[model samples]
Target chain A: MNGISAEQLNQAHQADLAIQSEEGVVFEHAWADPDEGVIYCLSDAPSAEAVMRIHQRAGHPADEIHAVPLEV
Target chain B: MNGISAEQLNQAHQADLAIQSEEGVVFEHAWADPDEGVIYCLSDAPSAEAVMRIHQRAGHPADEIHAVPLEV
Candidate 1:
């Protein structure tokens, strides 16, 4: 997330996409602002740990993962 | 984005929701980490500026906005 470029972020996304289903996670989408030293991933997974684990395996562990509210 | 609490974030979200339709934005979902001093919004809007202008009007302008990748 920090000191990374858009190209690197997408590279990591591709890596996660390669192994996500085996991890019981769906790589829905990602957003990042390298200027802010952060990347955000939105996914369908049972747990935040599952999401984190996938990213770790992909060599892109998330800085934080929060379940988003689906409705107001 | 900084020095704000979850309650305040929700308050801002509600404000945006009140005027989003007219602003040409659909408030899809939102995520925040008060500890990180950041809030992330996922919406269907014409442009990032549209998103920002709405939030600005709501008094919680976004710090950064990026078009997320839909596919690898």
Candidate 2:
């Protein structure tokens, strides 16, 4: 999603929440760079695919995902 | 940054912290998707430019930044 507005992101986020349970996904937070048209979402899921599926059903299919097994 | 490793992100985070105070920036958390060549960092700063300055000084210049005035 390039140059997406906060309103649009909020709508997509709501959709994700509506169906995330089916995929055992819990979206925790999301960050959007409307000027850059970049979005970063954090979620708790069994796998990246699960996260992808939720977004897809939510009408904002993720371009890609990465596993973050470690953090500071 | 593309295909950036977790280690790399951590190092960058450290660098950000080292000089963030100079720019009134505090980086809280960071997520890296090595497979997708993406990284997401959360920070509290005076402005998007302040955030960019910190990252730039840390050697990982942000491609763009967006204000998240609202969240769920």
Candidate 3:
């Protein structure tokens, strides 16, 4: 995972807050490392690309998107 | 991030459920990508090392720990 940048954080933060308007997805949570330019997000979506699409649409393409099966 | 394995997952799962016995830390959530061998964890602790220490003691040391100033 690449470090998150402030630009990415701003975009992700906005995306998380605004994602309810999107389809086939709901942004659950986001983690940012401003110094490392890495952004991690948790979301309910059909596929990894769906999550990336949301971020791309929000003007922040993720460095990588891995499926995380939540176990909590 | 390195991928998570079944063995690591079991350790982390048990650790999550058993962390209440530890000090200065609270396991909030865990996400595992079993196929990719990556495990992401969210926890409340005084520092990143606190989270790692708990995991290390639990027998599944995390590959990375990033501070996420959660907004929701």
Candidate 4:
């Protein structure tokens, strides 16, 4: 969480949306754990690399990427 | 990701759902990175502790818990 404020997350999310279309990524949801300095975002993308690219361009590169092929 | 399979995640998710009602937790989604040995789950719960409790009862205690109060 590293003292990240709601405003910062909102701004980052907005930035992500702005550039996502270029990568065929649709950000669905985001959750922040400010206490843990962690953020979790749900998105639809062509691949895990696409998600990471968007995040990197948005100015916050993800620490890890996981492919979610199945949902229940 | 640790070689965890989709079936394993499905089983854990089902177990969480079975006992979540007692703790006021609703697991919404889950994503697994078997290669990374990590599982990320999204849930609606009274608190981070409540979510952890449900996961624990289901036999998969989360390594970390984050409160997601904002979404985009």
Name the top TM-score candidate.
4
Which pairs of residues collide in candidate 4?
Answer: A1-A34, A1-A36, A1-A37, A1-A38, B1-B33, B1-B34, B1-B36, B1-B37, B1-B38, B2-B37
For each candidate, the DockQ is 0.24, 0.41, 0.43, 0.60
Deviation in angstroms for B58 in model 4?
A: 1.5
Question: What does chain B score (TM) in every candidate?
Answer: 0.82, 0.91, 0.71, 0.95
Q: What's the chain B TM-score of candidate 1?
A: 0.82
CA-lDDT, candidates in order: 0.76, 0.81, 0.69, 0.86
lDDT of 3 by residue, B11-33 (tens): 66776558744668888777777
Native-to-model Cα distance after best TM-score fit, residue A30 in candidate 1, in Å? 0.4
- For all predicted structures, in order, the TM-scores are 0.61, 0.77, 0.75, 0.86
Q: Predictions ranked by TM-score, top down? A: 4, 2, 3, 1
Q: What's the best-to-worst order under DockQ?
A: 4, 3, 2, 1
Tens-place lDDT per residue, model 2, B1-72, is 666766778888899999999989889988776665667778888999999988887788887577765454
Q: Which candidate, 1 or 4, has the higher DockQ?
A: 4
Clashes of 3: 12
For every candidate, give the share of true A-B contacts it also has.
0.19, 0.38, 0.45, 0.55
- Model 3 lDDT tens row, A1-72: 355555656665676558744658777767666555456777888888777777787777777788876454
- Please write out the lDDT profile of model 1 over residues A1-72, one tens digit for every residue: 446776787798889888888868998887765655667778888888999999899887777787653323
Query: Per-residue lDDT tens digits of candidate 4, residues A1-72?
Result: 477788998899999999999999999888887776888888999998999999999899998778766566
